[model samples]
Target: MDETTIQLLCPECTKDWQASPDDLPTPADMFHCPNCHASRRTSEFMRTDRDLQTLKQLG
Candidate 1:
C-alpha cells in the first residue's frame, strides 16, 4: 500500500516538508521543526486545516 503522507510547515522557520503520519506524534503533541528546532503543538505545523484534519485522522 502507498504510505500516507502529510504536508508540514514549520510555523517558526517556514521550512516545508513531507512526512508520513505514522512517523509523527498526535496532533495535540509537541513538534519541533527539523529546520530551526522551534517547538509548538503538532497542529501548528500543518500546512492547512485540511492537513490538520488529515493528521487528526491519520497521524
Candidate 2:
C-alpha cells in the first residue's frame, strides 16, 4: 500500500515540508514553519497540481 501525504510550503521563508493530511490538528489551526517560525493557516499554503505530481513521484 502507498501512503499519501500533503506538501506544505511556507510563504514567508519559502520552505517546504510534508505530512499526512490526517495528522493536521484542525482545519482552523495554523501551521508553523520550523525554519522561519512563521505561522499560517493550512489553507494559506500554496498548492498546485504540479506540486501534487512531484510528491506522487517522490513517493
Candidate 3:
C-alpha cells in the first residue's frame, strides 16, 4: 500500500499538521491531532482548500 501525507490546519489552535492518509480514519470515522489533541471528523478535514477544489470538481 502506498502512504500519502495530508496536511491539516487546526481551526482551534491554528496549527498545521501532516498525517498519513492510510492511517487516517475513513469518512465515517474521525481524526485527532497528535499535538494539540483536538479531534474532528475525517470528512470535515476534507474541507481544506486543497481538497475542496478537487472534491467540488468531482461532485
Candidate maximizing TM-score: 1
lDDT, model 2: 0.65
Task: Give the per-residue lDDT of model 3 (tens digit) for 1-59.
Answer: 85456666766676776665555666447567666777886556663766534433332
Q: Which stretches of candidate 1 lie over 4 Å from their true place?
A: none
lDDT over C-alpha atoms for residue 12 of model 3: 65
- Give residue 52's lDDT in candidate 3 (0 to 100): 38
TM-score for each candidate, following the candidate numbering: 0.90, 0.65, 0.57
With a 3 Å backbone cut-off (N, CA, C), the pairs that clash in candidate 2 are none
lDDT of 1 by residue, 1-59 (tens): 98878999997788999998888899989989989999999999999898888888987
Instruction: Score candidate 3 by lDDT.
Output: 0.60
Model 2, residue 57: C-alpha shift (Å) = 21
lDDT, residue 47, model 3:
35
lDDT of 2 by residue, 14-56 (tens): 8887777666544446767779988886555536655445444
TM-score of 2: 0.65
Off by over 4 Å in 3: 1-3, 46-49, 52-59
Ranking by TM-score: 1, 2, 3
- Residue 8 lDDT in candidate 3: 65
Please give the lDDT score at residue 16 for candidate 3.
Answer: 74
Q: Which candidate has the top score in lDDT? A: 1
After superposition of all CA atoms, the RMSD between model 2 and the true structure is 5.5
